[model samples]
Target chain A: MYPTDCRYTREHEWVRIEDDTCVLGITDFAQNQLGEVVFVETPEVGHVFDAGDEIGTIESVKAVAEVYTPVAGEIVEVNENLKDDPQSVNEDPHGDGWLVKIKYSSSSAFAELMDAAAYEEYTKEGK
Target chain B: MVDFAGWEMPVQYAGVIDEHRAVRSAAGLFDVSHMGQIRVAGAGAQDFVQRLTPNDVAKLAPGRIHLSAFLTPEGTYIDDLLVCKTSPEELLLVVNASNAANDFAWAAAQPHPGLAVEDVSERWALIAIQGPKAAAIVAKLTATDLGTIRNYGFATGQVAGKPAILSRTGYTGEDGFELFVEPADAGAVWDALLDAGAPMGLVPAGLGARDTLRLEAAMPLYGQEIDRETTPWEAGLDWVIKLDKGDFIGRDALVASRARPLTRKLIGYEVVGRGIARHGHKFVSGGREVGVVTSGTFSPTFEKALGMGYVETALAVPGTALEIDVRGRAIPARVVPLPFYKRPR
Candidate 1:
């Protein structure tokens, strides 16, 4: 099940607004598909990127997937604990597994993301 | 589930990591029915098989098995296979499913009067039970004394009341058995084994774990480690080739290649830096590409990224430093002795 406060993308990334910044991580569905995550490559805290830019990479035992940003923003913070405990992404993708926090350019980009209800249905349809 | 060759198979049942550990610690069952079985029989069977393989076929007496390869006249590998000697006049060849048809066609085309080579793959299914507790679990179901079936040996008997060929040979490094049964009887035998092995922590494993287990054991996969371009000398499998065993398909060519110095040699390595060095990743030293990874995985038993690759013989020494080009970033690695994990004997 998806968290109600978070917005979702078809790429299986999730974002939740936290005051002035947003916390981003992959969704639970994405973790299940990736199997056991062995490594998570996170970007630097001050890196800037446009919307849809590749943020980092999540390497599982079987395959690798790129983490993409849904909204253009400057990275504010990155979770360094993931370097030692990559399994957290598969164990708790929505909370402790958050990859980075970003200061966004506009509030309109958040609205474009699907809410919990739409995301659950969207995942059911699949690409 | 995914399609492997033409058969639909599970990549995992519980999970790859969990299943891999199960095989290492307790027990694991694998439905490997996709492997092909070819039978060679009749008057000239022994002589025909001896002339076809490099390994000493004379040593493969009744109920014995030995790993051998079908070689091209150039001394290159056609495919690696198991020669299961059922009797002096009959032998069962277990081959990779991907090369089953081609291997059959090649073997059948050879001119050998009074010899019968038939592809019995369609009628057979293979199931493997592996780990420390595999024998005890299998012992409960059958009357055939498990002790009599030595390693690399097989015996035909009833399993779960169905006729089957139980061989004490497996792809995983752990001690195990591979059961060859009629397709119709496979389901019952599989269920019986799982049910019997359940209390001992045996679970159904898949192709994903099978690969990791074999890699940890340093077993060479056909296409990845050995191919037409690779000779047995380069693959670290020259021990299987017996030139003194008399004339065979690739004997002369093997003798010629053995005399030449090896250009590349297979080596095992552990990733010193983060990131798994996957298949086809290039190994670089001082900005020059020196090798290519054949197989790699995050081993559950060791909990580190380990891989196998072929490097220039000069750089194949253990403790030599190299870098694996994973994506665009270079990850530091070091050469080590083969078989990242071995069972405590």
Candidate 2:
């Protein structure tokens, strides 16, 4: 189960607000669906990206998928620990699995994302 | 559900990685009913099988299963199958699901007099219970003494109050058993095994986990690591072929072919980078295409990537430098001896 404090995107990424910056990570559902994550290519700090831009890549045992930024922002921090321990996403997806921190264009972008209950309904609808 | 060889089957019940870990650390059950089963019975059954396979089928004792291959005239593999000698005049051949139709047709067309052949795939269902805890779990539900069942051996027994054949063999490189039961009782037996073993960490595994486990064990898959154009010697399966066996299908060709060294040999590779190599990927050595990947996957147990492919026999030695073509980018790889991982003996 995901905490209600974080906002979710339709692609299953979750954004948690911390001070003026927002931290981004994949949802538990996304990690579970991908199986064992063998490697994670996190975007470097100081990299600028627009909403829905490809920022990184995640490779599993079976295939590879691109991770996209949900909001326009510049990367302030990247998860360096993921390079040596990509299974962090499988072990603790919400905490240590945080991928990057970005300073968004506006704080109101959070309102455009789904809340926990809404995201639950969205995932159920997909079934 | 995922489509596997024309059959719709679940990749996993809980999830693939979880199921794969469960199989490695504990135990997992698989519903492999989609595999094909063919029966050969008649006065000339033994002679017919000996002529069809490259292996010496006449040497098999009752209830023993031997891994053998049906080959083409040019010594190319038709299909790799398990031939069980149930009686002097009766044999059961189990084959891969995707090759059932072609294998059946090929056998029917063979000119073996007084041999009766029948396709029994629909009449039976197969389940594989594999892992470290497999023997204990199976022993609880079956009347047979699983402790005495040696590897590659089988016995007729009762499971879940129904008649079944229990074989001490599995795709996972662990102590496990494969149960063959009546099709009508498959679902009940499956539920019974899960109910009895759930508390011990048993889960319903699927093809996704199966593929990863087999990859870790370095088992070859048909259509990928091998096909009609590949010979047993080239695929590293010469151990199953008996060249001394008098006159069999492709024997003359295999004998004549062995006089020359194999050009390409299958070898295992461990990926050293972030990329995952997949089927049809090219292998580069000294800046040229030297081989092709057949089956590759990230090993769940090792938490690293591994693959099996055919390379020039000269470069088949372990520790040879190689590169895998991943998304058009060359990723460094090295030829390693199979299997990439194995349980302590």
Candidate 3:
């Protein structure tokens, strides 16, 4: 089950808006599909990005997948803990595994993103 | 799960790191049924097998196993396999799944009078139980004396009430057994092994962990480390080739080429920097491409990046520094000795 407080992207990333700031991380399904999280390349804070921009990478023992930004914003903070213990993403993908936090202009812009029920079905289709 | 050589196999069950740790610390069971088995038996079986592989086949007495390679006529690898001499008149060849059909065809094509080569893959299934606790976990299941089966020794017996050929061999660089049983009994044996090993902390591992575990043990993979284009000398597998084995395929060329200086050499390495070097990554020396990585991964045991690569022989020394081009960025690494993680023996 996915958290209903956040909106999900087709890429399997989850984003939750609190006031003008949004916290971003990959969904549990994405982490499960990747097998094991070995390395996460953290993006530089204060970097401006548009939606769908290739921010960084997450690597398992056998694969390398690109992490894409779900919305346009300037990065505010990143989970520095990932550099030392990337397996935390597999251990706690939703809570302590949050990848980045970004300051955006409006929370209303994320209304178009898929809700939990829709994202759950999307993952079932294996898209 | 993904399609691997016509078989749908799980890349990882729980996870690669978890499975890898399971094998290292306690125990892990791997369904290696995808591997193919070919039987060679007849009056001339011993001589036929001796000519087919580079290892000293005659030295492999009954109930013994040895690693060997089926080479192209040009001294490159056709496939790497394990040769088990079940008896004086019988031998079994275990080969990679993707190369099974081709290897079977190649072996059958060779002229060896009085010998019969049969593909017995479908009739048998293999399960590898590996780690330090693997022996005890398996010892609880069968009546056979596992203690007497030295490394590479085997015996035919009943495992979980099913007929099996239990061999003391494994790919995880641990002390363990590879159980060869009938396909009809595979499901039951797998279930029984897991249930028996559960109390001892045994988990079912997958191919992802298999690759990483073998890499840490400094084992050569087929397509990556040694292929049709790479010779035994270049891959650092000259030990497996016995020149005195007498008139084997590729022996002439391999012997003649022994005096030639090696252009590139395979060496193990540790990623001292911040990146995991996966397969096919370029090995750079002085900003120029000189070699390539055969296998690379984030080691669960060492908790650092490790890989095997073929670089210029001059740069293959233990302390030589090199760069692996990871995603267009150069990450520094050093050529360490082989077997990055060894068991605490």
- Which is the better candidate, 1 or 3, if ranked by lDDT? 1
Which stretch of 10 consecutive residues in model 3 chain B shows the poorest summed lDDT? B250-259
lDDT tens digits, residue span B17-90, model 1: 99999999999999999999889999878889999888888877899999999999999989999999988799
> Which candidate leads the pack in DockQ?
3
Cα lDDT of model 3 by residue, A1-127, tens digit: 8999999988888898878789999889999888788899878999989888988889988898888887888899999999988988888888899899989855665887999999999999978
Which ten-residue region of model 1 chain A has the weakest summed lDDT? A104-113
lDDT (tens digit, per residue) of candidate 3 on B175-245 = 89999999999999999999999999999999998998999899888999999999999998988999987
DockQ of 1: 0.67
Best by TM-score: 1
How badly does each model clash, as a count of residue pairs?
Answer: 0, 0, 0
* Segments of candidate 3 deviating more than 4 angstroms: A104-112
Residue A28, model 1: lDDT of 94
A best-first ranking of the candidates according to their DockQ comes to 3, 1, 2
DockQ of 2: 0.46
Report model 2's TM-score to 2 decimal places: 0.87
Tell me the whole-model lDDT of each prediction, alpha carbons only: 0.92, 0.87, 0.90
| Residue A75 shift from truth in candidate 3, angstroms | 2.2
Which residue pairs clash in candidate 3?
none
